[model samples]
Target: MRLSLLDRSRTRAGRPDAAALEATVARAEHAERVGYDRFWVAEHHAVPGIASGTPAVLLAAIGARTSRIRIGSGGVMLPLHQPLVVAEQFLVLDALHPGRVDLGLGRSVGFTPPVRRALRRDVEAAESFEDDLDELRGYLDGTGPVTARPATGRVVPTHLLATGRGIEVAARHGLPVVVGGPVLDSDELPDLLRRYRRDFRPHRDSTPWVTISLDVTVADDDATARDLALPEAWALAVSRQTGEFPPLEPKEAIRGAERPAQVRRRVDASLDRAVAGGPATVRRRLDALADRTGADELMASTSTYDREALLASDRSLRDLVA
Candidate 1:
């Protein structure tokens, strides 16, 4: 049960400003020292709450500050960018960091229709994701005719971040694949893993790797842990329902506010899926999830408000899992 960090640098107080950038960078540096296996950031365009909308650029900065540990996107939304550009950008990252880069690709749009259109994505673009993925692979492998100079002949391990049918494509290509959020049944995961492992045709390696990301937050006491984690859980639920990034409010504050019963129900539902408690409780839950999923790696994204609480959760996780 290797642990990694998934950062969104979500704005908690109100507006996302320069303070968030400094805090995120500091947190990344702290994560490196605290023995996190990897620090992966996400990309979300035009989202007011998420500061890491340009993960490649943030990753470059992170790579510069940290001496070791992997730095990469949890995924770059491939449908929104040109594959060649992605290849070139990541080629530079690999050149700078060498054996410390992981390229994760996701097929979905990270933004809504208006923002997607602003980024030049259309309905037809979604269908072209597989083509773009193949082209990116070819470009990186040096087999494509339009040779990406720095990337040519350079093979960086690529992972496909998938939600549904894209998992099969990832397995067929023999790339590592990541499954994220609200996994309904444990049985379905092993079946997906079996399909990936069975059908995988490795291009660079003989075996395929599978990683899963989940929401996790730990504290010394169970009540305190839940208290710290509730805000982001509520925010995620609201975002899913509304497709808009709302201002962050403390859990108690939100609960006190006048809101619909259905909205409260959604927030409670989000908390059910998230792992939050004392270290012992969290460890037991994680071990069970790993046992059920058979995931090679488990990455945790904490939605705690206090930075110290977040760091404590990371340390507690490493110690418990170790």
Candidate 2:
């Protein structure tokens, strides 16, 4: 039942204005004080609505402001960057924060056609993920010498954010993995967890950790929870359908937009993945999901308009973990 904050820093209109950045940092600070185990920022590029295009830099900022809470990417989109550079960036983070860093890597490009072309990533590049992961490990383990001095002898554990065969790669490397999204059900995740546990070998220790991030929102009532979650749900749906990132609008506004029927379907599906309700209802859902999946840790990402309501959602999660 360990809890953490997952921030996307979504702006309402593709603008990460000064106010949004300030609010995000403040939220991270509040999360640390309120007993969150970690603060994970997502990496998205060329997405005007998301402020966290460079998660490593943002994590460094968050790390400097907080003492105990772990700070790292919810995941770094691996296909977009060189593994060595990523290793070095995180190596410095480990050097500064010691045991308080987590590096979660994901294989998805997370961008549209033009952006993917701009990044110069071919479809085959994703296949190199296994090689890149090994190279990163080699750099960290002191076996690779070129540009590897920073991370050598470091104990920073790396986790893979996987949906498919990437899970097997994580198991092979003996790293913890996080499985997410709507295609994953409570029943499916436990089997993956078992596979990881059975296959894991100790890079430095005998056992591996498993964590999952779920879209969640807790409010004083179910109606309010749904209301707060609409923006996030809509944005996710739009992203999925168009392969583009856009700022969220009110549900009523969305209904008025010239959206395709398929887009509406996608949005509905996104809403289904989100758990939104009062504290008691949310706790019941979470406990059921936990029992079903046996997830080692549960991280929550929320989208609420009001600062107070957002903080309340976080506080509710803290109480549930307690």
**Backbone collisions counted per model:** 0, 0
In model 1, the worst 10-residue window by lDDT is 181-190
What is each predicted model's overall lDDT from 0 to 1? 0.78, 0.77
Model number with the top TM-score? 1
lDDT tens string, model 1, 112-174? 678877887776687888888899988777877698858534587788887767779988888
Residue-level lDDT tens digits of model 2 in 1-322? 6788888877665344555566678889999888988888888777866767888888888888888888888798777788778888888888888889988888877566776888888666788888888887777666765856465366567888877576678788888877777436645667777787889877667366767777788888988888778777777777777667777566567657787888778777766778888888898888888886677788787875566678888888788678
- Could you tell me every candidate's TM-score relative to the true structure? 0.94, 0.90
Candidate 1 ranges beyond 4 A from true positions: 151-153, 184-187
Model 2: lDDT of residue 112: 68
